[model samples]
Target: MKIKFRVILSISIIAVTTLMFVSCASDPDSSGLEYMPDMYRSPAIEPYVDYGEVRGRENKDLKLKRSAMIPPSGTIPYYGTDSATVALMMPYARKANVAMKSTHGMYDAVLTKENEYDFALADKNPLKLTSDNMGDLFDTGKKLFTANCAHCHGAKGNGNGPMVVSGAYVGVPDYANLTNLSDGQIFYSIYYGKGMMGAHNSLLDKREIWTLVHYIRKFQDTDYGTSQSAKALEAN
Candidate 1:
């Protein structure tokens, strides 16, 4: 009977020891047992909210000045995941603009030496020149071009697309002709109107226009007439 009692007592002591050990363990709340390091957590959200607010404020300020925003609910596209994917996949896709169709109709005056000259192409659509393997700049240029210039320039830099031909536009210089102009010249023309072209500096920011200038220069050789004048002008 004493032996059995001693055995039972030993078992009780073991159970109490285990309970004490468990109780002494670090508290889940204090020990960060359930907490995760930032590395394990999601990436910090880009400040889209602040951006939206700032953009909204800017829009209000510029409402009376020439408005550049694409009309709400218009077919003028906002960038999408597909745009980025397509840009990555194909050079042709990267040059295409989302705003082309709308920009086609914005022209009220037509200036054409012949029915062949297309000015709407330059007037509406913006370009996206991807620099030498500068992917981030390329992506940014692509988005800006789509947002501001696609309406007239078409999806590709090729001038044969819907926007220019379908709308009330003429003298739209094709991308081929535009390429002959150097980056500085292109920026100059965009800033100060040459010929019938209006100044886009008021509408597009500098980097945005410069990026488009490169994109337009890319297709200018294959699409339209070229001039040594751009070369001569550059030399001078």
Candidate 2:
């Protein structure tokens, strides 16, 4: 009886080893041999990563149809409550200049017959910098800037960012020299992007852009938001 049991155990071990080798030697394109096929494909949506295949099944419909598409017209995204915040985030009243249609790729956007950049100079920053929230705003602005603007604008807003210093980019202007620009014009430039820069409105929301306007003000004036006089000079 003992010899019979030992023989059966040895045969079972050999069979399992053979199965393991066969499973490991599957076809390069086949996921059918996987123990848990679901684990092979990422459950999370990853940007730019193809999800057209899973468990060796090729899904033609899952392939990306288009990398990007323009948003439909006459639609506005909800910016949430806080009337003041919503009001500040509302679409700019002025339209892009007609010349910018070709120059700035404002073809789908509402373009104005006249050059509207000069008109933007009259617009004011809606997100006011009060003494109470000034500290928090700047902190948030710094984080946003570091992530978005620092590469091109530099940490000091001096136009000598890593991109410019490395010779990969040019035409980025210094913030100190841009003191003449109104808060609204700055917002416009950032929203739509200006001179070699593309539209960042898709990347950044309105509230965040307004905060950047305040932060840019800080670059020009170190004592920004500390005095009413400074605010008076900036309100265009």
Candidate 3:
């Protein structure tokens, strides 16, 4: 009976071992994915497109006139101060100070010396004779010249004005003959005064002298006598 029991026990153990070995063998297709149906396949993962809160663009349905709606950026404020008062006022006072400083800082320095002219300074804006438009510049120039330069250079720029007539000065240049003189040369002489003349550099600013030069050119082409006659008739 013992031998029979041992035989039955050994058979049962062998059967259980064989079943365990079969289960451990490589599976043909027991993977969870292998049993999935075609419909169970996940749809292709589409990329995300979140556009609800994006800045700088608007997606709307509307129709309107053609116009721009861009708002302007804030502008920076601009401020300036006039510190050139000293430069402005100094030229005005410079004329009378000629006694202490023989060379007036402006054009007057040229009057103290002769033949030795500084064209660089004279050609500057105070003597811009070349920029007379519609003769207004010349008219202003003439008025200023009559007020300032006529004393010695003469009312006609002919060196024979009241000052020269009274023997107060000599050697004023004739503007009629200035056809040979460049605008720069004429401006130089006016700025620094030639011969017995003193520098107007102190008495006049650059623009004033330039305007005067512009008017001087008008006298070159104009018949002063005719104009004077016309004016005299108009006065009557």
Candidate 4:
């Protein structure tokens, strides 16, 4: 009776081991049979995931559909409850020209038949420059410019940035020569892009663009935004 029991126990162990190896052999990529597959793999949907073919089952309806989508028009992202900040963060009033669809690839932007660039000339900088804020504003502007514009616009705003120096780009106008451009025009150009420059609206917020406008002004006039300049502006 003892010998027979030993033989039965050895056969049971061999059978269990063979079954484990056979399960793994079914799929080269998969390990042996999974006890709880969902524990390791999440069922939650993610953006940009192709849901057309899931678990070896193909769904024709979802084949070409993208998970990511553009936001609805006039949708304002939350900017907290600060009235002043919210106002400053509001969407720009000027619409891109229809030509911008072809010229700047702004296909989704609200397009207009009118020349909004000309309209922007009359728009004034909403960010007021005071004697107290000039220093901090310029400091922030310099940092923003360095990170975003310096590569193509130059460290000194002379259109001699590294890209121009390397002979990779041209036609970048110097800020010193653009003294005739109004603050709004400068802001618009930077926001929507001008000539070889691409639109910076995605990279910079409205306030930051306005701040850059102030900093660009300093390039044209060394004493810009200073107490003396403030007095000069007030007198004018």
Model 1 TM-score on a 0 to 1 scale: 0.36
Clashing pairs in 3: 107-201, 108-201, 110-192, 111-192, 126-206, 126-210, 141-211
Alpha-carbon shift of residue 80 in model 4 (angstroms): 1.0
Q: List model 2 lDDT by residue over 139-228, tens digit each.
A: 999999999999999999999899999999999999999988888789889887788987777789888998999999889888787865
Q: Each candidate's lDDT (Cα)?
A: 0.47, 0.81, 0.53, 0.85
Instruction: Show pairs that collide, candidate 2.
Output: none
> In model 4, which regions exceed 4 Å deviation?
1-42, 48-66, 131-133, 230-236
Write candidate 3's Cα lDDT for 78-137 as tens digits.
323443423322332112223324433432221223233433333333332222243566
User: Cα deviation in Å at residue 92, candidate 2?
Assistant: 2.7
- Model 3, position 209: C-alpha lDDT score: 68
Lowest summed-lDDT stretch of 10 residues in model 1?
Answer: 91-100
Q: What CA RMSD would candidate 4 show?
A: 4.6
Ranking by TM-score: 4, 2, 3, 1
TM-score of 4: 0.74
11: Cα error in model 4, Å: 14
How does candidate 3 fare on TM-score?
0.42
- Per-residue alpha-carbon lDDT of candidate 1 for residues 191-231, written as tens digits (9 for 90 to 100): 44455455564477555665666555445533211233353
**Residue 103 in candidate 3 has what lDDT?**
39
